[model samples]
Target: MCKGLATLPATCLKSAKDIKHKISFLLQKPEPQAADQKQMKEKTAAAAAAAAKRVPTAAEVEKWKESFSHVMNSETGRTVFTSFLKSEFSEENIDFWLACEDYKKSTTSKLTTRAKQIYQQYVEADSPNEVNLDAATREETRQNVENACPSCFNEAQKMIYILMEKDSYRRFLNSKLIQDLSQTHSDTAQMKKKKNNCDCTENRQALAGGA
Candidate 1:
């Protein structure tokens, strides 16, 4: 049998080099077309515009600054907070919070699938994007997720939320960015008030002149 295998025709056997070359060929990606490149650029610009449009109003910022929960619950608050967190490389805190929010809403049928995904993405050790969790909490989360419980990550989520609340939230309130925005908002309001007063004064003068 060994001799028969060895004597098989040359066309019947692939050499090591040929197998490697085949794999390399199969893995090669095609170059993107000019149209695809243009589409990508347009998509990126649109996404940037959308993010800018989501900037919170001054009142909204003040509201969020009052409560950590408010910031987490509000989309505009989350966007602005996440931007600050990103600058500090701690955006994972809000990322985990949002993921937990979405995970909690998963339908029963999708619970297992979504739980596993969240665990691997944000809870698993050695995961690139894993969030901070104590060993005990991490172990508990691992066990809970094994059964796909709706609240599998509740403990871990709360830890991250508290971390952000105590740390990032304070920094956000005091940051130069927030201060500048607050000042700008005040200036804008003052300008609007002045414009309204000027318009009223002009109307009164016009009536007096007519009289």
Candidate 2:
């Protein structure tokens, strides 16, 4: 509903669009629509593990909150954050930033192909996932891409990273997904601690009887 946002200088409209996407993503059924309870549980667990990695430890999840770079550094953090960004339909920034990171590490042979794809997807004005960039920056990227090099998208990527660090990254830290993950890990830790205490109590009882 961020209407009339088809052109530049629509910062407010862009923010509205982001807000709309976040709301849409959050408004989901409490359970899978077509599945029975068992199926729902199985599917939910599998999907969560796939999207967020194997039940991220509380320590690991907390580490992500230390910085945007910290979140980007961990595989679990990246996977969860990317999924969140995609749900919000505002993934172009991180996606583009990641594409640039990959492009830089590409073998010489893959450089041109990766560069072309990155430009077509994120640099072109009408690209399916066009990132918000200014006229001067976009034009500069255009020239660099024509030549096809690893550094071609360096400037554009930096801008997108800043955009995300300022906007999306902040929202991500406060999102429900992160909250749920933190709670899940905390619960798991408590359950484990109780089990350990129970075992210790039984061991002490047995040792006292033996003595």
Candidate 3:
């Protein structure tokens, strides 16, 4: 039977090798055409041009500076600022702050370290809850507990819940701080406009009285 099978398989062996070679040939990627290369170069040039055109205006810089100053100076602003430092600012920016001769490096380092630690804690704690473990028998018990009572999933579940709560609270505080700052700036602008209008009205009245 083995001799008969080997003798009967020459055609099948050739067909299989042909199919394998065809698959290999199909899988070989084609190099980019000259037109594709030209198009990529044009795209790169256009992006560079667009980037070069984007210069910051003096007014925009001043507005940012004012907002930064307000946030850094006031107590509520300080809290918001710290949160922003924790959430928005990049490590490079944080490093720049730490590098400032006037600012204490230890304080900046502590804030940056704390923010990173919290962020890591939040990510680690949140990820486990999101993982789909339906295929795992061990996780079936966890799934059952989750279904029965989400509050009963042990330490990992509790940690995730606490982290989520902390994140939500931080987000709320950040939003409120932003709203307050926006309102304060808007009020200041309105008051200035009102004062200017009053001055103009007074000047016009005095001119009419003199006339």
Q: Quick one: best lDDT, which candidate?
A: 2
Which tens-of-lDDT digit does each residue in 40-143 have in candidate 2? 33543454345442545678778988998888777667666766786677866766776687678778887776677778777899986799999999999999
Model 1 C-alpha lDDT versus the unseen true structure: 0.66
Candidate 3 lDDT for residue 209: 92
* RMSD per model, one decimal: 24.1, 15.8, 31.2
lDDT of 3 by residue, 1-211 (tens): 1123333245444433443343233222233334423343354334333332322232432343454443333333333333343343222222222222111222533434333332222222253113211234224434443333322223333333343334433453345434444444454455556666767887888899999
- Tell me the TM-score of model 3: 0.27
lDDT of 1 at 152: 87
Reference-based TM-score of each model? 0.70, 0.69, 0.27
Q: Considering only N, C-alpha and C atoms within 3 Å, which residue pairs clash in candidate 1?
A: none
Candidate 1 Cα RMSD (Å) = 24.1
lDDT of 2: 0.69
Write candidate 1's Cα lDDT for 98-142 as tens digits. Answer: 767766877899788777777876789976568988999999998
TM-score, model 2 to reference: 0.69
TM-score of 1: 0.70
Q: Which regions of candidate 1 deviate over 4 angstroms?
A: 1-54
Query: Candidate 3 — which residues are off by over 4 angstroms?
Result: 1-79, 83-174
